[model samples]
Target chain A: MTGTELKNVKVLAANIRIDILKMLEKRGYGHLGGSLSIADLMAVLYGKQLRYDAKNPDWDERDMIVLSKGHAGPGWYCALANCGFFDKEWLYTLNEGGTRLPSHPDRTKTPGVDMTTGSLGQGTSTACGMAQGLKLKGSEQYVYLIVGDGELNEGQCWEAFQYIAAKKLNNCIVIIDDNKKQLDGYTKDILNPFSYEEKMKAFGFDTQVVPGNDVEAIDEAINRAKAVKDSAVCIILDNIKGSGVKYAEELMANHSVKFNTEEMVNKNHAAIAELEAFVKGAE
Target chain B: MFTLDHERKMGKRELRITVADAVNELMDADKSVLFLESDLAGASGSGKIQKAHPEQYIQVGIAEANMMGMAAGLSAVGFKPYTHTFGPFATRRVFDQVFLSGAYAHNTINIFGSDPGFTVGPNGGTHTTWEDVALMRTIPGAVVCDAADDVQLTWIVKEFAKSEGIHYVRANRKAVRNVYAEGSTFEMGKGNIVKEGKDVLVIAAGQLVSDALDCAEKLEAEGISVEVVDMFCIKPLDKELIIKEAAGKKAVVTFENHSVIGGLGSAVAETLLEAGVSVKFKRHGVEDRFGQVGTADFLQKEFKLTSADLENTIKGVLL
Candidate 1:
């Protein structure tokens, strides 16, 4: 919460947003929507909150983070690269064959990934297990799991939530990226999660709803969660699918935008340029 | 040759007690060893282990899927988690969790699928898991073994402690003949040749090993000269031993307290086919059928997984 640390987080967040745009632009088409939505949250976590060392990513005492909504891995990969877990040049290898940066984060391949997660609700259960294990071993390291709001439609998520609360795993933190969109359309049109906070509170979690794009707010909530002594914390992040770039944010299906022509690629570059200019101006 | 009193004086310990006692000893020795039960501790005869090691025992309600995932997580952070549940739930209900979390993810979690096959008895078809062995064997990189008796159970627990990755140990709740000696050595992927012969080979695992041994004895009296091999490890099968036995013998009869499709019989068949050994083979087990309610003895008889049935199958195959 220091002024200098606050500035670092904002800079990291802006850089992460730029990285997501560049990766998507390189891939020609990818999950720009949901991935961009989580950039600020990832910045807050990787920059100031989560206890991790990029140099020793496998440090046994490091805090664990599970990206349950693994399609948003570009956002996580960007943060990891920015944090020096691996070279930022490796970002272009996203979704490429023979590359360690897979579409879904593989724990063995990625330095900072704690669990290999892609099958939706299962990762939360894994996070719960890690948290419980740490508590059993009397380790102070925490586990942070991020699940897409639409991904909460899976019954297994609820099952994991109940177990986390039942075990009273105060060391575990769950963040639901409420971008409100999924593969088909909006979550409410698909399967509504109703109220993320109320549902999590019912399952015995200390619930918080915060503006997902605000790094300061995200960091404050995470600090509050760290201070909580008894209950597991659930943060419902209210975020837009494509939060930074103008063209991508305006598109309807930014989840996996198809940039077929040279014109589309140029447009994406222009939008990224605008974001870069705005970031530099703020600094 | 032995009278009823002489048989009673043999003083062999029951298999269920042996398994429970071994688990209890292990829990007492290792604090990192945890036992998660799905409300079957009393039936599995491991209530003592749970009672003595309450700190290490977790009763995860009756949710088998959740329990499997939880055990995987525990294994990820260095706890040796042993989840005990009935065979049906342990194999069928939570198979994905076992496949992905335990095997594919390479977690060293041991699953005790107790009361395998018709060993559940009057607990009936609903509880009997004749296909559990087949189901577990289908998972890649899974070490599936069914302990023949109390001695094998002790060896299996010890072996599993030294080994890594996922292991599914099928436990028969009913008491069976004690085949191995008190201090007999057991290997995970090596089969024990109980009775050596030249005419035919009898391959079996779990409770059916005793039936094959009895059949081998019966066949010996009739001058059939049968060899009985205890194929304990079903997955990563000892293909070299199987091929050697198959090449030496004219025919092979496989027995298991499971379905003939994908259990010990199929494992032997697959190995023989791959080795290009043209030995005649027959299987004695549940012939792709579900089980019914009865006593363990009665169900074994009903399912045709008995000494007489195995003997007939062996004789027919050899002839």
Candidate 2:
């Protein structure tokens, strides 16, 4: 990748992190854990990798992205708003009644969303279908899908993974946000999806593991996968939930924590301030 | 001895031949038009289309859910995909995929749910989908169509090809009476009034339209002038016509080869209630029960989904 492009991805990743913080701060409570984990990846995709036009979100030739772990849509909504798919002002409306930006990304309502996916593993299967369809039509556009590591426990995801590899959909890229924690608790204690990389590879995908927060490494892997032809590639991103915010990261119950107390609100604000300073210093 | 034109023009034998022919024609014209089957191509008589257009046809090997997802994916990238399976599998087996990927996502797909109701005959209750219409109608934005005969099937196939969004066209493999003449046009959500009467209105859908017409003829002998309506589109129903007919009629009888709960009967009831038409009504269908293995004729008799049953229901309501 070019130096300029690499620099752009880094900046975009940081911006996405900031966007996530701002959105969470506005909501006062949301799925910060999973959403923060995939922020950098979303930055890399929306910022540098994905070939999509914000002006024409419905462009037939545009690359498709399906957020299988749709609960992390706060991060995606932030990414979409930053990328100009819709106004950034709409980010505060997340999960509110009558808001186009629902808790889950709805394709009909959202500007850049390709499919409405909230039902765990169903999105991955839908992404596989989109990729296969692109291949059948001989379209060069690719399909990028993000699934939560914990969400892989869903049988539908494996079913989709099998089909994607079986079809040899080279135009598809699957990124699993390995945040370890699910709704109730950690993934290992609940239902361990032992080794995602090995499992995907066995299912015939060209699999790789990367630090989800490292935008450069994720971009390089995606570039390498894009270079390959006639093979499905999966990148299992090892990430910590609420990586950017120190307090949110430390708190176990912050997966969908509501900032009810003044102290909790102050802690969230402090985390956002720290992230902003870190991003400004990096620039 | 069946000529291609003769088969196409005829109503009873038309459904099997015309659908297969239309699919073949679509394949020839647009390379993007694809047909996916779930091991029932031979039974549905779509094997010829598959053979001639092998590249356009996908045999998914009995995995109905997988086929549904695959079809959705194909549609995502501009391919107009049509999936064929028996009514039971099409409506119930992979309902979630059909609901999300096809209907909810607004994918351009047409599902040919063949062997609806007692049409599967010897294949029995396991294969016959008495509740397919009810199941399909519940899906939002899903257009459910049951063609009366082959003529309507041919027209529906042609129209479906040009139309966009999710459409479920229920077809019976069994032969039935042809009602429409050649060049007769039918819209997606409009009902066709076959025989007009002032006494009562008989609203029916699918193969039951034939039975409704027959009931109308029988009812005429008893001095009850019953109007027969072919309520083809179950979802986005022809409310205006239904209300207009129901308002003037003494009573209304709804006949369908599906469950009375969410099928044509329910739709008619909802429409009538909304319009505030206080007409006495009787519903003749599968009375909230699962079907058993039997011949098509036998099952129809067992389920009371015949002209005689419909006439009796109408007469009983009148009494």
Candidate 3:
């Protein structure tokens, strides 16, 4: 990716972080770690990589994507809103009663959410099925999945991995956000996954590990994955628990942030202000 | 199960074979028909269709939950996918996915669960599922049907092809008696009255439908009148016919191959309660208990699921 393209993605990712903060602040409490961790990848994919029509969200020829860790729903909704799928004002109504944006990504409720997901490990399997169905119908469409490191603890994810490999669902790409933390604590302290790449390799995936926070790196990794046909690819993203925000990263416990307290509200505003300043400086 | 006396005496085809053949016809006719198997296609007889058309068949190998989510994903993309597995795994193994991913996600898919209740001989408690109907029907907007014969089964498969939303059809793995004629068509949310009598309303589903009819036959010989209703469509419970036909009868007797707690009996009981109709009801089937391995006959006799049991149970209700 060119420097200008990389810079453009960086600006989009920073804006998405602000969107996440705004939504969570309005809702008073929501998943912050997982959503923030995937902002860069979301920016690259939604900003440049994906082939979707904002007007026709169900366009047949477009590539389909599933956010396996659906707690990151706010991040995805922000990406869609910014991309003109809907107005940005909808982000404030998230998690409210009768809101289109629920706590999780629901395809029936949200316009651009291809599949409903919140239950861990299930979305990856659905992605596999979607890719297989498209392949069977002889469509050149691709199915991309983004799963969290904590979410891989679900046996169904591995079940999907084995099935995709066995069925040779080459049209699918599974990106694992190795954020190294779950809702409880650090993933290593909770339940050690050891290495997702080696496990995915053992499960017969064309494995690749890249810096998850780098938009340019993820773009290149996806391009590389696109070239490898006849097999599914698993790209591991080594990102922080809270990628762009220093307060959440310092506390290391912002898995679900509630800005109800004075300290938390101040910290959130400062973080959003920092992101906005970064975007302005880039310009 | 195939249906009707004329078709019955003419060397009837296996019930599962009818499902496979109907699905095969569907695959040939519609490009959107996709089938997912959890390594039981051969056992369920869908393997025949899988062999003829590999493009539409997907074997997820023993991962039933993944098959459900996969089917949900396929449904999102406009493919009308049907997932097949043994009875217990179909509902018990992936109940949450069927609810959240299949139903809540607004994705439409069909699930065919074979070998319900004691009919899964030798595979034992782990394989036989008496709770499938209860669990399946409980899902909001789920179309739950317990198809008694191939005529109903074929109609259901075709109906689901053009229909929308989640559907679950549970039928026997092998042939049983035929209740309906060969070319009979069925609409969803309607009940089929096989025999008409005024003394009692006898409602039944699955393998027990034939037995329920036998009990009704024996009661008729003793100069007692009985009405038989084949409630294939369990959900959208056909309350209109259940009330209309069951009017002024001394009682309604529900017999099923599933547990009496939440299967056909529970549905009928709820209907009777809501309509505020005072009808003495007798619930017969597997009581709240786990299943065991034995021939269908042995399990039926042991579990007190025989026509004789139905006869005694109905007699008790009549008095």
Candidate 4:
């Protein structure tokens, strides 16, 4: 990607991070770490890669996104809102009673969320089914399945992965966010998924690893994945648990954090201000 | 319109074959109608459909939870996905997925769980599921039904083709006694009164429906008038029919192939109590026990699920 194109996506990523922080902070507590980690990828999807219309979210010809690691719904919702799928003000009502933006991605409730997911590995199978449906219908549309590294602990993910690889469902691109940390601790300390690239390769996927928070790299990786024809494709994003939020990245309990303390509230405000400035400068 | 076959002969078509034929007809009619099996094509009798309509059939291979989510995914993309597996796996094993992906997500999926209750035969306790109806009833907007014959099972599959949301229809794989006649049509959420009487009302579902009718016939020979109503649709149960049937009856007896704790008995009990239609009520079935390895007949007797058990319950209730 060119410098200008990369900058554009980075700007998109910054805005997504800002919105996520604002929403979570407004709600006082939520899944902060996971949402922040996927901002760059979400930006790459909403900014350059995904073929969707803001006016018609359910357009048949558009490419779909299934946020399998649905706790990161703030990031997905922010990206969709930035792309005009819904009002940006709706982000403030995240997880509130009777709100459109739920704590997890719900296809029926959210505009751009193509698959309802929060129960970890179930979305992998759903994405495979969506891909198979597209193939059966002879549609060229693609489904981007966003999965968390920690979410792979679910056996259903492996079941879905095997099916996808065996069926050669190239239309569904599997993107695993290898943020290393889960709800409890580091994934290695917990389940120890060893090497995702090796595992995906053994599972018959044409695998690629890229920095999670890098806009240009993620964009290029997705482009490569889209070009593959014969085998299923998987991209592993190797990056921090809280990619853009330094305070959360350094904090041990960053997964579902409460900004109850004065320090936490201040830190969140400062982080959002910095990202907002970056977006403003890019614009 | 809710009459019985009365002859009580077993339907010529096995329920598995009936389900397969209905699914095949659905596939032939609509390109969007798809069938998914979890390595149970032969068990579900959909292997032929799988062979003929490979594009429309998905063999997910032993992943019941994944199959449910996959069907939800297919549903999201406007495909009417019909998923088949054993009763336990379909409801008990994949309850969360069915609740979240299928029902909570508002996706349309028709789940056909074969070999429910005692129908599992020697597949044993692990394969047997007596809580499917109870589990399915808890889900919001889920349509739960139990098939007593091929006619009812066939109508349910075809009816669900145009119906939206989560639907679960449990039936036996082998041929059972015909509760409804051939070419019989059914109204969803309405109970079928097989026999009318004022002495006692026997509300039953699945394999127990035929037995309940036989028990009613036996009681009639002994100068006792008994009513047998097929409470097939357990979720949006035929409350009107149940309330109406329970009125002026001497006693109410619920017989089912499931545990008496939550299946047809619980549903009927709740309906009767809530409607204030007080009567001598008895929930006659497995009393909070796990299924054991045995033939259907042996297990039925062991669980006291035969017509004789219904006769005892009816007599006990009348007294």
Candidate 5:
């Protein structure tokens, strides 16, 4: 968590924001709030935390990441492209016909995505499974999971939480992006998930609450999770609905939106400029 | 309905017991083969494996969705995982996981969906999965299979152990009437023509194989030449054998222990249509009805899936 590392991760996050905005803007509609909210965490992961070979994406011994809230795929795709998992040119192909990158993460098609996930609760379960599998093989690899706060509405996520703790899958690290917004509206208006830390602890996880916007805290939480031997860790990453983009962040509910109209396109461009200014601050 | 009168339900425990043993042996041979249960180890007749190989058998505790993810995770790291539960729980309960984690990820995990369709009997509509075959068939590259008898079930468990990707193995927990002889070989995606004739083609699967055989025998004795084919592999259907045996026959009657709409009959109808062949065809099974508590005879009479129903359907088609 050095200053240089923090700045580098911040730049990466800012760049991912730009990538996501540009891609979705061109596509005219996509998940914005969830994708933007997770950018910093993805930045810290691909930039400083994860140990992977971009050249050998399928290396047998490499650690894994399954984005259970897979609608945030554009943000992850940006991170992978920045890390050289694939060419950056492929990012624009998001959700298009014959594109490897779809609206959801497909491991078979995408280069760096470890598990295929679009359905909310399924990824958490798969991450737990990967943790157990890696343990059985006696591999020291970690399975990193990024789950959305709203995604917890699916009962499968809780089922996965219980299984991970029951199996004592300490090799897995779950980060809950408590952005507090979903497709319909605010999570409170939809289904109020009061406290993730308490719920996670009840499910037998070694839980922590961290500032989602802080890369240093995210990095530290990941390391802390790795140190625990008998219990899995759940870090509730408290974040703003839209992290860096002002236009997106200003929306009362920017969950999944469209920029198909002329006014929205101008607003999108303004958001891009705002993200660019944020990168200068990182420098 | 379909009745093999003198033959009792003797093979149920024997087959289940043998499966438990085979699973244990497979686990012993390969450290990677992990066995998972959804708190149904006792019901699935694997109490011995539970006691013997405690490490191998993981009781996922009524969490079928999480069980699927656990199996997928185990498969990701090169472990051959066999997830066992009743049919409805395995397919309908956690279908999204089976689709994304299991099939889409191309991870290898053998799912044993025991007690398909009416075999759950008293378990009723809530427990029985008449739409599992239809549901599983929709998944791309998924190997959907239904066991005909004791030998086929045993063989499928062993074969799918080494095969890759998501595979569905649906069968009854009870003893099935043995059809293939000991050491008889079977191929995936290739239907076995158990009996061949010119007048009628009877394609059958699961516990209904015996009923189909009985019906074919009765029809044959009545001077109607009947052919019976065991369509064990339902998804990667034996279209070659289906066309080879069924296309030119006087008529085709498909028998299954599932709904007539999306099970074996639908697959056969779609295949014939795709191949551009016109033939008199009828699907003999539960005619779009929810299951109820009864003997297979009573249920079959209610749903018209018995041998008598098969005879009537065939006669209506041919005569």
Candidate 6:
């Protein structure tokens, strides 16, 4: 990736992070840790890799995304809005009554969200289905499935991984965000997911582990995954729970946080200002 | 209106084979119609289609939840996916997937839930699903149906193929007593008065439709006229027909091979009560009990879903 391209993608990630914090702050409380963790990967997708038409969100020939760990819907929504899939003003309507921007990614209500996911481990299987369907139709489209490390506790993810491996659906790129935190507590305390790399290898996926915050590495990993022939592929993002937000990163329980407190709101405001300035300078 | 066939003999083709044949016909006509099974291809009689149309067949192996999500995914990408599993596995086992991924997502898929209720038979309590209809009915815009015979099962499979939304068809895997003639067609959300009379009305579905017919015949011999209606479509139930038949009748009874709590009986009760057509109503089914290990006949009697039970229920309401 060129320096200009890398810088542009980093700016895209910062914009996504800013939007997510803004939307969550407007809502007073939302899923923060997991959503913040996937901002860079979402940037790598919407900014660089994914083939989609914001004008024609239903474009049949475009690549698709299934955010399986749907608590991170804020991140996905920010990416979509930044890419002009929908108006940026809609982000303020998150989880409101009669709002299309739901707390989870709903394909029926939202534009460019190919699968409806909130229930963990489900989108993995859905992605496999989409990949197999594409292969059946002989279309050269990819399905980028973003799964949370915590979401893997649900056995359905493993079931889907087994199917993807058995079918060798390289068209479905399995991206696991190892943010290491779930709703109740840390994933290691809740359920020890030893090593994502070893598990994906055992499941027959050619795996790659990359720093979650690095947009360049994420882009390169996706390219390598696409180049592999006749084999299932996976990328494990080794990221912190509250990835881009410094205040959220140090806070012990950042899974879902309230922005109602003055300290938290001020901290979020400060972070958003910094991200916006970075984006402005890059642009 | 449905054309009722008075022939009470067994259908030549097993219900599973009938489902398989209809699905095969669909796949043959449209390459987009995919048949997905969760390692129950042989049990569902879809193994034939798997052999013939390997390109259109997907065997997802024992993961019911993943299979449902996969079906929804296939539906999302413009493929009309038909998924088959036993009743419990199809509905209760993966209800969240069916609701959120399939129905809520508007990624519609046709689900064929085989071996409902007593039809599961020797598969025992673990496999028997007495709550599938109730569970399926709870899904918004989900079309739920119970096939009584090969003819009806074939029509359900073919009709739901073109229909949108989450369509669930519950039928037995083995042969069921034929209640409709070959080439007989039925409409969705409509009921057929197989045997009409004035004294009482018995709304029935699934394999119990044949039992209800026999009970009506026996009640007629005893000078008590009984009307038997095949309410195949259970979710968007034939409320109009139910209200019409239930009004001014001496008694109303609902018969099914499922639990009396939330199956055909509950739907009928809700419809009749809401319509304010009050009558001596009774639910003749497994009286809120789990299934047990037995032959189909033994389980039918054990659950009080036999013709004899229907007669007793009506008598209790009348005499």
CA shift of B132, model 4, Å = 1.0
TM-score of chain B of 5: 0.94
Better of 2 and 4 by DockQ: 4
What is every candidate's alpha-carbon RMSD to the true fold? 3.1, 3.4, 1.6, 1.2, 3.1, 1.1
- What's the TM for model 4? 0.98
DockQ scores of all models, one per candidate = 0.59, 0.49, 0.83, 0.86, 0.76, 0.89
User: Residue B179 of candidate 3: its Cα lDDT?
Assistant: 68
Per-model TM-score versus the true fold: 0.93, 0.91, 0.98, 0.98, 0.94, 0.99
Stretch of 10 with least lDDT, candidate 4 chain B: B1-10
Model 3 agreement with the true structure over A1-283: per-residue lDDT tens digits: 8889888999999999999888889889999988889999999998878989989998879998899998889889888888889999999999889999998999888888899999888898789889988887788888889999999889989888898888778788889999999999989889999988899898888999999898888999999998998677889999897888888777677789878899989999999999999999999
Candidate 6, which segments miss by more than 4 Å at Cα? none
Model 3 spans with C-alpha error above 4 angstroms: B1-3, B6-11
Off by over 4 Å in 2: A1-7, A59-61, B1-17
> Which whole-number lDDT from 0 to 100 does residue A20 have in model 1?
85
Ranking by TM-score: 6, 4, 3, 5, 1, 2
**Candidate 6 TM-score, true structure as reference:** 0.99
Clashes of 6: 0
Candidate 5 per-residue lDDT, tens place, B217-264, comes to 888899988898989999799998888887679898899988888999
lDDT at B275, model 6: 87
Give per-residue CA lDDT, model 4, range B1-319, as digits (tens): 5456779797787889999899988898798999999998878899978876888899999899889999999998989999999999999999999999889888988999999888889999999998888899999999999988888888989999988899999999999888877778888998888888988988988878899888989999999999888888898989899999889988888888888878889989999999999788899888888887899888888888889988987877777
Off by over 4 Å in 4: none
Clashing pairs in 3: B2-B178, B3-B178, B3-B179, B4-B178
Model 4 deviation from the true structure expressed as Cα RMSD, one decimal place: 1.2
Candidate 2, residues A79-122: lDDT per residue as tens digits? Answer: 89888989988998887899999988888899999888776777
- Candidate 1 lDDT over B234-296, as tens digits, reads 877889999988776889888898988888888888888888999888877898788789999
Q: Return the DockQ of model 2.
A: 0.49
Q: Residues B1-319, candidate 6: write the lDDT tens digits.
A: 3466676798788888988899899888999999999998879899989987999999999999999999999988989999999999999999999998899989878999988888788999999999999999999999999898888888989999777799999998888888987788999999889998999999999878998999999989999999999999997988999998888899999998878888899999999888888799998888778888889888877887789888988999997
**lDDT winner, 3 or 6:** 6
Report the Cα lDDT for residue A146, model 2. 91
